[model samples]
Target: MRRDEVQVTLLYVFDELESDLGGTVSMREHSQVPESVTTIRDELRDSDFQVEALIAEGNPADMIVGVAADRDVDHIVVGGRQRSPAGKVIFGSVTQSVILDSDVPVTVVSVDAEGEGGDRP
Candidate 1:
């Protein structure tokens, strides 16, 4: 589909416990408005797509699904971390749950590395 025709909604899941505890969390601080949504919107400003952002409390998977269903979004984009074998089993994968539960198509992007470069456009 054309960029302009795409209806994209970015869901940022924040845990209140983490925020309240004052831990060194990435999404809790940097993604208050959901950085992914802002980045995509700014990048695609010239395009015809409509970008919306939602920050919700609770688990990421449920919030993502809820927003997708409510917005009737054509696609849902979520940012995730690439976990190690042990980490995957221990923490599980939120991206997996979101992809499985979402009514619409979901795209998971990994941005774990610092200097790693990829073609965003």
Candidate 2:
């Protein structure tokens, strides 16, 4: 989809309730988030997409899918981290769950180091 036609919603889910600030706050007022989200936001700001960042505390996968469904989003694009089988088993995979549960099309972006050599387009 063309960036100008599609709205980009940057979703950040805090697995721990305490990690999310309960009150409403603009993105500028919020200090806690993965650095990648900030970087992506900056990059998107340079592009044509209208970006909106959303932060909530809950099961990451559930929150993601719920938001997509609630917003009637056309598609969901999420970042995934490479992890060993053991790690996946221990922590579970949020991307995996989103892919499996989301009704809309889902694009998974690898956030692993291997894709970081000026990978973003």
Candidate 3:
């Protein structure tokens, strides 16, 4: 499907960290995110795609699924990285989690070790 035909929301999830006091640490006010998101939004806009950017703080997979549900998006696209079987078993994967949990159709685009985009193997 062409990007311009669909409304796009670019979401950036800031992973919540645990503080020394055992409280949730928020990066909602992070400075770099705005600029980064803007750069991405601008690029898509340049490409003639309708798009918007959103920032949410929490687990990446959960935030993605939650935002999709909240926004009533028709589809969800996520990036996946190659991992060894042991690594997959130990660390799990955000892409995997979202695929399993999301109600909408999901698409996974894999990135290679050099950060080049590719179809998932």
Candidate 4:
């Protein structure tokens, strides 16, 4: 990040039920902010970056792209985890949807199961 003014929005989206066909489901009902989001914000603040934290509930990919568009952000950075080919086919990736749908440039930070790999600025 340049020394010039820059604002970073740290957004975390909670998954919501996809359909009403199933009986009432309950889990993750509360809207508490995730510790991971707070930790990331703290790290960014420590690095002298201005940060805004936002929590949303919805389809992750849609929410991410909507926020970026609504906020008019210059770029989007999303984290993804590696999965087996079968798993990938079974659980389509939110990151992939955001990459395909986002108007702004997207940077994917992919990590392994051990969280050992990712590109960093």
Q: Highest TM-score, which number?
A: 4
TM, every model: 0.67, 0.78, 0.76, 0.81
Models sorted by lDDT, best on top: 3, 4, 2, 1
Query: Which lDDT tens digits does candidate 2 get at residues 12-103?
Result: 87764333557433443444677777778888978878999888877789999999999999999887888999999988999999999999
In model 4, residue pairs whose N, Cα or C atoms come closer than 3 Å (at least 3 residues apart or on different chains), thus clashing, are: none
For model 4, how does the per-residue alpha-carbon lDDT over 2-117 read when each residue is reduced to its tens digit? 73278999998887765579743333486666566687788888888889998777788999999999999999999889777888799888889999999999998876665345
Best by lDDT: 3
Q: Count backbone clashes in candidate 1.
A: 2
Which portions of model 2 miss their true places by more than 4 Å? Answer: 17-31, 113-118
lDDT of 4 at 108: 89
Ranking by TM-score: 4, 2, 3, 1
Clashes of each: 2, 0, 0, 0
Who is ahead in lDDT, 1 or 4? 4
lDDT of 1 by residue, 75-104 (tens): 776667777989989887878898888877
* Each prediction's whole-model lDDT (CA): 0.68, 0.81, 0.83, 0.82
Cα lDDT tens digits, model 3, 1-121, are 7878978999988888778998888866653564545766788899889998887788989999999999999999876789998999988788999999999999997766654466434
Kindly report which residue pairs in candidate 1 clash with one another.
4-48, 4-49
